[model samples]
Target: MQAIIFANRTGNELAPLEQYYCSALLPVGNKAVIEYTLEDIVTSGITKVKIIISSQAQEIEQLLGDGERWGLDIDYFLSKPEEKTAAVLDRLSLSMTDSIIIVRGDIFRSPCIANFIDFSKQFSNEFVQAKMANQNACMLLLPAALSYLDGIDWPLTHDYDSNSVVTLILHGRCHMIDSFQSYMNANLNLARNDIPSLTPMERSFTSANPEQDFYVGAKTHTGDLSLQNAWGIIGENCRIDPNVVMKNAIIIGNDTLIDKGSTLENCLILPHTYVGEGLEVNNSILCKKLLISLNTEGHIEIDDQALIGPSEHQASTSSTDRNLSTRFFILMLLIASLPFCPLLAFYALIRVMFFKLETKPLIQEMINDNLGRSLVTYSFNVPTRLLSLLPQLFLVVTGQLALFGAPAQIRYATGRNKQRLGVFGPVQLLLDEDAPEEERMLLMLEFDNTHTSTKYLSLLWRSLRIPRLLGAERKKQNMTH
Candidate 1:
């Protein structure tokens, strides 16, 4: 029988992580979440499959192209997140006579589909539901039970043929990952080998202590690991420095670096992150400088590069530490703009007095002080877009905002994202103001990825023209109106 995998979730639950990838593509135990789903579908001996996707469809398609390697033909259908599941299934015209397995591709589940299907063979013509204690993992939809798709919920407690229905408890684990806390717990489950279906890469590196157990990948340096009753999986090309103490459950993703004199316990380190020297990291997901606490569901990013940063930045030209020339450039702008602050404040005062404007002259916003390293809040939000933002040049001076990188400018937003605001983004300086959002984003990435001294000065010169540009644009708008 054919299977339909629902991978189209918006996955607002995964946040921050969702910013980079769709939930199905997120890395878990060193494998994409959907990869395990594919393994289960292929292992269950189902060939023809359909995946429903919406946002980031291109990345998902690039990852699971045609599903040829698994000896299966795969087709993708687009669906809005809010659309009813029954409507999408009804549109598929799946068959009235045959049974099909329906699974959520974005979540992680244990007790492989093959085992679940084997145990579920007892009932021939009824709705079969598989679940752990509180969550539903998946379901087998028989023709007789297909009619109740829209109204069904777990407990199979009501409105079904009581005698014909079947509920099988595989006594396995299911991680719906409906929240970040659940997502962190899923990794803990993997570390503990609680999910039998997932085989986290080969356990290669043997620890120094007999009590220490580690599953390490290729080219990893575990020479200095001092573990006391600790066990975990670490990915490829990692560096675990000397005098480092690791304990309990840990999952370090590929291309990570755990520095000297640091203590890590019960933490999941995402790939390309650098844990600082001599710091204690525990019970959290550490990515770059960002630390997300699993216990409290709170997150903090440390800006001190010697403490925490991106792995690549630790070894190379760091965006966190600004160069002397860039600092000088920011100083020059700050000196230029400091004079205008009082005038802008007076304007704001007048607007408040006569125009009944309720907004404060300046509003507080939090931003990454050094790229994405540390978070700092500043007063940069003003009602006026261009001239009023002169007061915000101090953020660039303070290294909280970039002069020539990423058009994240509260200084240049053509959109409405007041959250985590900053100023003096050079997006409009590098690309046409009317350029498509995708093009603007690409340009910003270029600025972000490669901010050479020569390039920085070129963009700085271009920024000088913003006043005339803003004036001309304002005239054009007035004429149009």
Candidate 2:
């Protein structure tokens, strides 16, 4: 039977991981993640497969070109995300009469296809899905013919029996790793499960030195080194350095070097990178272009494109504690004085009658509990008019304080030491591994705002809730992160 798999790689739902690696190239076992799923389909006697890809189609094409290796007739379809699923089925329906199976490329499944095929044979014009509930994987059959004009959403409440038609196979535990910690955790789990012990392509990619437990991709090279389960997918025409010790790792695409005495453990090194001598990378993922340290969660999504280019060429060399200098102190006095002109008259008029006014201290304790010190501190008996203005001036002068940052920090907040200056306001709370991306971007942008007036002004406008152009941009960035 022919299966038209709708393999769109644009998985925005997975977040930042989608920003870096495509689903097809995400390393799992001794091969890319999608390879395992494809093998299962081919083994189930589905000979003809059509793959749909958006960005990284070539990588899949290179691996499964003409599909002779797997004895399946394979073809590829490339299109924008919006034009993907429907477009492939529309083109396929014109020629093929056999049943089709549509599956997202990123999902990993096995030992469940036999049931799927049995279920699909029951319906002549139905869609079958490999559904997993808890540890049980079953095939769900649905009687829905191919109609590109109207997309159908399978009703969740539709009753089903062993013989009744059902819909897609949805896994109860299938999750896409979208962050650094999650990615790391997945690799760690796989490593703990002895994924590395699996043999590399026996006849295809192998090193001349024949060190044990080393993984090298097709037409790739690994120099003399004693390695164990070090996953390296060296593309065609790629070279490796000798004397490199890599363990529990993955390398993708092309052109990289592991300089002598470099040890990479439980990491992902992407293409076009050169690791210097005596480097130790553990539980990290490098895009050859960018380096990322994954947290305990096992997902790493480093913004590699931003790490490149002339605009942001340098790495984050500044210390985490580093922030805008005290040099911006001069701007403080000027800002604090601006609102004083009209405030003076208002204060005098109020002082004429109400003498019992016990003014509150303008300099409240900072979110971090740094006492007496503030971006700007005000004493008791400060004019009512000046009270409101002082806080705004304080935000402007400090340059570190944002007009609106995180929810205000509470007393004795732990991890406050990690706080950095932000464009809009100070993040009262400490950053955790699972901290949201908006918080990270805010901290990163703030730390980079070093005495640059242009950046400061831009941040100030962002804090002010500027209309249209800037506001829309802030919202978009917030939603994306």
Candidate 3:
């Protein structure tokens, strides 16, 4: 039987994580979601397969190329966004006499397809709908005589009524992973040895503790780490710190590092991530720059490179230069502010004399000369706001701040000290100061994560517009009062 697999379905349900890869390419255990479907088809004696794909078609092509690894004759066809599954089949012009099996690329199942084929042949029916629970497992057996029905505008559901009799096959082992929770659960099941063993692929590294149910991929290093009541799967070339502890976790991709004293439980850490020291990551998915919570289905982008960042090998030199340039720009601003020093002093004296304003010394954490340390500074009240800020500009000259970075508050300094504290930044210039704290934090984190030298001109423009923006905001606030 020939197989027709629709691999183009958009993965909108798995947002954030879907931003990086197609749904079919999502890693389950040692293999991608689509690989399981392919293995099932190949095992069931289907040698000729047609894969219909869209979006990340090239990525899928590069992965399954010619299908030689599975000893199948594979052909790929690109499908349009507006086209339905029926239209895709018609466009491919599959032979009328070919006994065809249709499968959805995103579904995972360990089905004995030969049984389904045999069951379908006894009825001489046009279609056989295989139902696992209430959902269509995306598996359909179409008799050769009914190939002309491929153009029918029907959804791939059990609700279809073909000209011939429809046979139903109930298979409970099939799973449809349309969300982050389902995806994580599937992998967790695999790690826990709850599911049947998948076909093992070749590996470079041996399991540190073969006694435990674990799958360690090629070139991975356990480094004296121990698993407890968990089945761990570490991808190729990952470094697990000796002090780290894991229970029922799956780490995919390559070149990841689990830092010292970190504990992970039922978490999925994507490739090239660095889990910082002493972090307790539980029931979450850590993709590049994003942390998705499995329980709440909420996600956050971690812009702090030191906490959970790209691998060291992927760190670009341009990022280093951009940071250095920010420091230089801050130093220039401090020099320009020197003339206003006397005005600041006079204003401070007026505030103290009339407003009874008292300046309090504050010890603030700062990134000085590329090192993290505390700096002694004076706090300013509302009446002396601008005046008190002048003395802090010296921090710019001393390499403690960036002209266009985060606020200098210690609470905002929790992440990696790589980002320079600044007087004004994209978050401060664009977002209302009265906005919810969580919203503001998310925006700032996103800004820090995506900002680069390419955004230098934009940052400069925003800096120039800050005075006008703040003036308008102040006017608006006064009107509200």
Task: Please tell me which predicted candidate would have the highest lDDT against the true structure.
Answer: 1
Q: Candidate order by TM-score, highest to lowest?
A: 1, 3, 2
Worst 10 residues of 2 by lDDT: 148-157
Q: Which candidate order results from sorting by lDDT in descending order?
A: 1, 3, 2
Model 2 error, position 174 (Å): 5.6
lDDT of 3 by residue, 1-481 (tens): 6988878866777887776667788877757889888887887888999988885775677678789989999998988732476678777777756678777776666555667777778766455655565555566666533543432222333355544546465654556677887887677666555565453342323344554455677777775443344556677778887787776555556678878898888789887678887888998899867889989999999897667876763444898787677667767876887786666656556656687655422313333333446565443332323334556666666666655567654243222344566755555455544555555565565565563776756755665555335446656988999
RMSD in Å for model 2: 15.3
Q: What's the C-alpha lDDT at position 343 in model 3?
A: 66
Those runs of model 2 whose alpha carbons end farther than 4 Å from true positions after fitting are 11-20, 82-97, 122-129, 133-256, 296-481
Q: In model 3, how many backbone clashes occur?
A: 0
Q: How many clashes does each candidate structure show, in the order listed?
A: 0, 21, 0
Residue 313 displacement (Å), model 1: 3.3
Top-TM-score candidate index: 1
lDDT of each: 0.67, 0.48, 0.66
TM-score of every model versus the real structure? 0.61, 0.45, 0.59
Give the better candidate number (1 or 2) by lDDT: 1
